[model samples]
Target: MHAKPSYTEAQLIELLKLKNQRAYNYLYDNYSAAIYGVICKVVGDEDEAADVMQEAFIRIWRNIEQYNADKGRLFTWMLNVARNLAIDYIRSAQSRKSSKTESLTESTPLGAPGYTDAIKIDHVGLNAVLDKLTVEQKKIIDMAYFQGYTQEEIAEELDMPLGTVKTRARAALMKLKHLFV
Candidate 1:
């Protein structure tokens, strides 16, 4: 759906190899949007996508010298750079977010005598919303979020398919999001 480049790509690459600023400018002018599009698709957040795009460009600029025509076009190489950076950024963000959430959960304790759980305040906040959620949703939410069970664990424990568990979890979250927001 995109138009072909007006400039010969090989010429741009040759100039790029020589470290020409104009060639870099031309490359950005012609391909920044496409690269950003790829990043946005992976990150699914505009602000984070912008950050990933900036990092991707920095990586491409530094690694341009390693690109070879025999492997593929300069454009493809640059596209890979952007996509990989975006995916890595997303994964790292998820890791950090999960760690923080676990830490918070660990600090919470179930007040029952001789019964200690990582969750402290889950009972207070989640109880109000439980009535609003479907049976399946409530079960999934309890296992995954409250009871600290993984998707695979839920599926195996309940004797259901993993895909079904995931789909149900997603639907449950959507329902809760609609209810709360």
Candidate 2:
């Protein structure tokens, strides 16, 4: 296996700012799998996740100049970019599903093959475990995981400090992990 190149965050930022192709190649080699996994978990489909991940990389490249170290690490910013795109995809899908349901209800041929209520078996267990979490834990976990809100966005919505959001998110993750494992 080829080893990935490591660069300090500052060095990475400088390289990316200069539009160094090597830096971009290093980034994809190292981070694409992690980003793809996150997108897949959020979108719950490999195909859609791949689509979102591609768009996210484009966005990250396009917005490299806007990154600020004082705000957070570059990876965190990139993760948010990927996550926000995934969440946007989810929202857009939900909107389309709702619209489709409306149209289907209005006029659909009798005995349609794809006209049944499908059960999302994965979510049943997830919701059960989520119910066991504390209110704070559940809120933070839901907004971040299911809703794909960034830590900064969560803090802004909850009016809490970024550190506190991180702490709660960590706690919530541990709690959920314990329940599942």
Candidate 3:
């Protein structure tokens, strides 16, 4: 087996900016798992997450020149891209339509051929993290992150000002950040 190529973040950035195919391949090999994790957290389904993952890499490749090292690290920018794509996927009209159809098809008649009871699986880590937040913060985080609601959508759905929603989300994330560090 061939050894994997390694590049320092700076080297990788330079190579990516040059549009080197090898650099792109190396970037994908090294970073796809972390990127996929972020996508999965937002997208929440294996199949859909896979689709968004491909789109995210394409976006990263095509938009590599737009990345500003002064703003943040490469991974952070990529995560934001993947996260935004996932949010867009969930918010899309097609996704909404599919979700509705999926729900209808997922339900089986009582005593039918392929009937199964609904499972209640607790996301312990998510719950623990959420428990640290206030009721207002929790509502915003739940809707924005787990339920895949955009901040604007959350504000509208909650009848809150968009600025207020943004403030709450920022504060909530800050608190969660403190918990880990």
**How does each model score on lDDT?**
0.71, 0.76, 0.72
Off by over 4 Å in 1: 1-6, 99-181
Tens digit of per-residue lDDT, candidate 1, span 1-181: 5554456988998888888887788898888877876676556566887898889988888887899999998898998888778766755775777752353234223322222231456445555676678766776764564345578878876689999998999999998988777
| Candidate numbers, best TM-score first, in rank order | 3, 2, 1
User: Between the candidate structures 1 and 2, which one is better when assessed by lDDT?
Assistant: 2
- Per-residue lDDT, model 1, residue 15, is 86
Query: lDDT per residue, candidate 3, 120-169, as tens digits?
Result: 23245545765787877766765665446677777776799989888889
Best to worst by lDDT, what's the order?
2, 3, 1
For this target, which candidate reaches the highest TM-score against the unseen true structure?
Answer: 3
Error of 1 at 84 (Å): 0.3
TM-score of 3: 0.67
Candidate 3: stretches off by over 4 Å: 93-131, 134-139, 145-152, 156-167
Candidate whose lDDT is highest: 2
| TM-score (C-alpha, index-matched) for candidate 1 | 0.52
